[model samples]
Target: MTEFQAKEMEEQEEQIENEAEDNKEAEDSAPAEEQTGQSEVNEETLRNKEEEIKKLQEEQDELKNRLLRVQADYENYKRRTNEEKIKERKFRAQSLVEEILPVLDNFKRALDVQIESEEAKSLKQGMDMVYRQLTDAMEKEGVKEIEAVGKPFDPHLHQAVMQVENDEYEPNTVVEVLQAGYSLNDRVVRPAMVKVNS
Candidate 1:
């Protein structure tokens, strides 16, 4: 071949090699750009998952609080109900005791009458025995007489129907018990009808 044709052929070969190199660089850059885009999508997905987890944790905490409140309310209700039951049991016999008080007073009046005849004395003895039995039964049921005479008058235990000036008792004191009063379990079932010293 002539020298001029050989030079032209070499130039064409160099141009072909440069074009091949450019194509290789473009292919390598395209994959790198795609990888960057994939990394951005992964970061967004991770942020969304973290937000969902936080919301779920908050909901769990709220549910736990509600459960604790319900448990506390149940405990309070049990305690209150037990207290009410105990109080009811303590006062269960109060109404029966009140009903028997008038009958007991009648018995006391009968025993107070003076009798001279032997037959009457025997009947009195029998009545006294019955009275004692009744009193003993009342004591067993937690019934007790309220002390009024010669004691400091208390509104809770005494009902003052009349006021009198008396030298034997201090002021605001109970001078006499007109009607007997009774108590059960340290609670007044019937307050003493009394005369108070002024």
Candidate 2:
């Protein structure tokens, strides 16, 4: 073959080989494109799943916080109810003590009667015994007499019905108690009517 003809034949063969290689590459790249598209879809789905999980976690946290607040409110309500019950019990006891005061006064009136006869003496002794028993019973129920005759005059526990100028006692001191006062649990049920020294 001549030199020019041989060069033209070699150029034609190289062109054919290049065309075959391009066809093979196109065949290989088709599946790669499909795989890349699938991968993108999977990544988007994974992101959506992550977002859903985060939202669920946030909702759970909110519910937990609400439960804690409800528990706190319930505990406060229970505490207030208990305090009210205690106050109600105290008031009830105070009412019963007030009702018994008149009976105590009647007992005192009976004990104050003076008699000299033998039968009357026995009766008086019996009355004194009954009075002592009643007083002991009241004391056991948290009832206590207010101190007025010797203690300083306090308006909270004593009512000054009369005043006296006395040298023996200090000013504003209670000289005599005209009527007794009673207390229950450090709360005064009745104020003592008393004479104060000026």
Candidate 3:
């Protein structure tokens, strides 16, 4: 072969090698670009996940607040119910005490009457003792007698049976009490039957 032809063949081989090297470099650069794109997608997914977590936390907080409010409402309802029960008990006690007052007054009237014999006096004393015991029991339960004799005839406390004209006494005055009145806890159970002076 001629030297000129050999030199031309060497130059052609070198050019082919350079072209292969450039192709390899281009393949490596394409993989790096693909990796960068994948990283960007992963970052976007992570940001979306963080935002979802924040929304869930907010929902949890709202539910906790609602639960607290419900608990407070239940507590108030319990307190109110207890207070109502106590009031009902007190009212029932007052009514029961009022019902027993008339029986006690009858005993007092019976004791005030005079006895003719010793046996009768002994029986009367026993009855008086029983009356005292009953009155003591009533007092312990907050029962009391209303004032009626020789006082002004108040419509709230007394029921006037007969009116009498008297210059010695003031008009609308209670001259005598025919039936005693009773009270339970400052509330009148029965008004006194009285004779009023006009």
Each candidate structure's TM-score, on Cα atoms with residue i matched to residue i, is 0.70, 0.68, 0.56
> Over 4 Å off in model 3, which ranges?
1-75, 89-92
Give Cα-based local distance difference scores for all models: 0.86, 0.82, 0.77
How do all the candidates rank in terms of lDDT, highest first? Answer: 1, 2, 3
* Cα displacement (Å) at residue 195, model 3: 2.6
True lDDT of residue 17, candidate 1: 75
Query: For candidate 1, lDDT tens digit of each residue in 114-194?
Result: 899999999999999999999899989889999989999999999999999999889999999888999998999999999
Error of 1 at 146 (Å): 0.2
**Highest lDDT model number:** 1
Q: Considering TM-score, which of the candidate structures 1 and 3 is the better prediction for this target?
A: 1
- For model 3, state the Cα shift of residue 152 in Å: 2.9
Off by over 4 Å in 2: 1-55, 81-92
- Residue-wise lDDT of candidate 2 within 56-105, one digit each (tens)? 67766965786697689679979999999987776666777899888888
